[model samples]
Target: MNFFYFAYGSNMLALRLQKRCPSAVFVESATAEGYAVNFSKLGRDASGKGALFEKQKSTALGVVFEIAKSDLKSLDKAEGVWFGYDRRTDFEVVTNSGETIETTTYLPPKMDIQLQPFGWYLALVVAGAIENGLPQDYINKLKSTPYQIDENQNRPSRLDALETLKSTGHSNWQDLFTSPRAS
Candidate 1:
């Protein structure tokens, strides 16, 4: 059995998603109604990660990925599903082509935390959004999202991800960084 996973945040990046599910294939660009992306999940990297924020009249833009059932556990582990994000198959997404697909989405069990995403983390998101050619206005909104510099130069994970962006044709996230909150 295969599963449809709607990736709205970092998973929007092909490279990042590839690392998690080698067999994963992009189905299409899709949107979930009445939801918005929220940087409310506290990550092990000491930065905030994206979660779905429910509100009326808001929709989130994302990509649909088809993953093999066998790879679900690995994908779950990569997403901290058993710990941080709670996986739910309750959501539905509509493709730009107007097809509605039932799929899985993740959110924090609790969303009380409000924190800015690390610059590198936010960069991963922006890179994915641009690579997938999500709406320009949505990309602008992503670019405008607030972020922080994870200055602990010793963080290999952060550095490694930034490095991986090169393969995706994105220069260093910080080097090209521009935040509306900054200026």
Candidate 2:
């Protein structure tokens, strides 16, 4: 069996998601109405990660992926289900073509408003949005989100994500480092 998963953060990048869930396959671009993307989830490295916040009259755009049921455990482990996020399946997202689909997604167990995402993390999100052909306005919004540079220059995860973005031929990948909103 396969399941639909909606990705609104770095996982929206196919390359990034594939590393965690090998069976993930892009389905379509979708929108979760009444939600907003925020970088307020506390990450293991003391940085902020992406999370969805419910906001009336707002919409959060993302990509829907079809992943094999067998890989659910792997996804759970990668998402740190025990502490980082709570997996939920009750969300309904509308695809670009007006089709509504019930999909699973992860939400932070708690939010810290003072946290901000690392530059590399947010870049992965912006790159994914561009790679998936999401709306320009939405992309711009993501790009404009404030981010902080990881002082640990040799962080393995950050290195790997930047390498993937470069290897994948994302033309503006370098710009992400220079153009983020003032931290």
Candidate 3:
């Protein structure tokens, strides 16, 4: 069986998704019309609470990927869908090609996410924002987002991690992993 997933958050970081599902195929760029993507209250964990992706009626750009049935469960776990998200077949047509697909979009079932403009999860939201052509001002807001404290100190926002890299003068994290360091 084939499943279509609409990735609006960090999943736009292709490498991240590739790690989760090696066979995942990128289909095309699409948008969720009448909806806007925001990182808001997701849930709490030992590390810290997080802001998850939420869709409002303002349209957000996204990518669709085809995943194998065997990989869906793993992907769900990686996404923390086990807690905040409930997989559903209620997805609608967002493609100009008139293709209807069902996708696993994460949402809050209990309460609406109260928007925190500088939340830590904004870093994870960056990949999606950049892909969707969100304005530079918004991008800067994401880049400068401040970390929040939950129950733990280890669960800093993605921006905080990136800032740590910047402070350590290792601004290029991609290079740290992808490049051979000086011997």
* TM values, all candidates: 0.92, 0.93, 0.62
lDDT of 1 by residue, 48-149 (tens): 898887879999999999998888888889889867799998689999999998998887886745688888888888888888889878887888788888
Task: Report lDDT per candidate.
Answer: 0.84, 0.89, 0.56
Q: Kindly indicate the candidate among 1 and 2 with the higher lDDT.
A: 2
lDDT per residue as tens, model 3, 98-160? 566667665544444453433334344555455545556645555544444343446544455
The sequence of per-residue lDDT tens digits that candidate 2 reaches over residues 1-183 is 999999999999999999989999999999999999999999898999999989899999999999999989998887879778999987899999999999999988789989999988998998899889998778878887888889998999888888878877755565854654433
- Model 1: how far is 147 from its true place, Å? 0.7
Error of 3 at 174 (Å): 13
Top TM-score hit: 2
Best by lDDT: 2
> What does the lDDT come to for candidate 3?
0.56
What does each candidate score in C-alpha RMSD? Answer: 2.6, 2.9, 7.7
Off-target runs (Cα >4 Å) in candidate 3 are 46-57, 96-100, 112-121, 131-183
